[model samples]
Structure formats: C-alpha cells, structure tokens
Target: MLLPIIKCGYELCKSENSENLIARAYPQLGKIFQRFAILQFFNDYGEFVLHDVDPNLLTFFRSCLSR
Candidate 1:
C-alpha cells in the first residue's frame, strides 16, 4: 500500500517538472508519505509523531485479520 504510493510519488516527481507534487498527489498519497515519514522518523528518533494510539495498531490489525 505504502510502496505503491511512494512509487507513484517518485514516478510523478521524476516524470513531471512541477514543484507541486504534494498538491498533485496529496489526496491519494498524503497518508502514504505520512506513514513512510513516521517509520523513517522512528528509525531516526525512536518515536512516532502520533501518541494517542499505539503504533503497533497497524501490525496488530494485520495479524488479527488473516489474509
């Protein structure tokens, strides 16, 4: 999910000469980049921006709902 959004953003940023990639894809990719940023931020700072919910909620949700 995040991969696709990142790929799309990269492709858009690479393919277009515009400086407004965020505006162009925010509706579609904003959350994706936010998530990626959160993960990267955690890797760098050992914490996420959102503190209201456990960060592991995503992992737990995935584990509970088997594919």
Candidate 2:
C-alpha cells in the first residue's frame, strides 16, 4: 500500500480506513492484531508546521488518532 509522505500524515494514505486491509492483503498480520488484547491500530499526525503538506492534515490525523 502506497502511503503519503511523512509530511502529509496517515490520513492521506491509500488505506485510511484500515478496517480490512491486512485481512484482505495479509491475513497473518490481521490475526496478530486481532489476537493481541491491547492492540491499537490508528493513523498519526506528522510534522505540520515544518513539512510541506495539507494545513489540516495534521489536525485531521490527530482527531482520527484520538478516536
């Protein structure tokens, strides 16, 4: 899966809704995350002010991560 640059954040990744990518693409990884009781899969906010990316990308990533 192609991902956005470090400046853009995970929000811009191809699989932002990672609800089933591993299941469809890599079943082993999906099983690992599902079996782990404390596993947490989430997007992340990248360097906003310093990197060349969307202005709202950081905030959007943060909001999604917080959930």
Candidate 3:
C-alpha cells in the first residue's frame, strides 16, 4: 500500500521541479490513506507506539506534518 504510494509520489515529484516532495504530495497522500483507515490506525496507536515500531516512519511523518 505504502510502497505504491511512495512510488507514485516519487514519480510525480520527479515529473515536476518541486523542491519539497513531501509538501507537494502531502494533501493527496493524506486523502488516499485516510480513507483506507491508515490515519485511524495511527491515531489509535499513539506516537510512542509507532516510534517503537518504526522510528523512521514516525520521524518522516513528523517532518512532513511540520512542513
């Protein structure tokens, strides 16, 4: 699921001259995953739990959201 989204984002970003890939893809990515219950899954499991599972993923999300 995420792999495909990441690939799509990469392709889209590569097609453009955008400096911030995350910012460009954030809104569309959020909409796609949010409907699939990904957002709910993250919400149900706290950030601490997510960090424990995958610190990099947590960090990535934090960085994207902060932008």
Candidate 4:
C-alpha cells in the first residue's frame, strides 16, 4: 500500500540534484536490491556517474558517432 508512494517519492528525488532528498529516499531501495554491494553500485555509480552530462547532448553525440 505504502510502497507505490515511496517509489514515487524516490523517482521525484532522483530527478533533482538534492542529495539530502535522495538520501532520504535511498533507503527505500534496500528491499529491491537485497545486497549491499549491488545497492552500493547504484549509490556510487548509477546516480553520480555522468550525472553532469546533458542527456540530449549525449544522445546527439551517440547519433553523430553512429553516422
């Protein structure tokens, strides 16, 4: 019952740059991951890695490369 609401909150936090918001929502992922290492991967690389890259720019770059 409450899970959907928490997932929604996590999604909202993910779209923003607020680490505090993210941290608050981050614990909700524990049950899904089931492993600390896998969770750590998302914490370290999944969110932070390439976070500064513009999605549109990256898409354009990929298209340019494909051509």
Query: Model 3, stretches more than 4 Å misplaced?
Result: 20-22, 38-67
Question: What tens-digit string does per-residue lDDT give for candidate 4 at 1-67?
Answer: 4468667876788788689988765664653344434434555676666555355345544543355
Best by lDDT: 3
Ranking by TM-score: 1, 3, 4, 2
* Tens-place lDDT digits, model 3, residues 13-65: 88986878658677867755664454456567766563453554565576545
Error at 18, model 1, angstroms: 18
Candidate 2 lDDT, 1-67, residue by residue in tens: 2223222433433446665543464553343344332222122333323444454445444543454
Off by over 4 Å in 1: 1-26, 47-67
The TM-score measured for candidate 4 stands at: 0.31
Provide the overall lDDT of each model, using Cα atoms, as 2-decimal numbers: 0.59, 0.39, 0.64, 0.57
Clashes of 4: 0
Which 10-residue window of candidate 4 scores lowest in summed lDDT?
A: 31-40
Clashing pairs in 2: none
CA error at residue 52 for candidate 4, angstroms: 53
Candidate 1, poorest ten consecutive residues by summed lDDT? 58-67
List candidate 4 segments past 4 Å from native: 25-67
Top of the candidates by TM-score: 1
TM agreement with the true structure for every prediction: 0.36, 0.19, 0.35, 0.31
lDDT of 2: 0.39
The local lDDT score (0 to 100) that residue 60 gets in candidate 1 is: 39
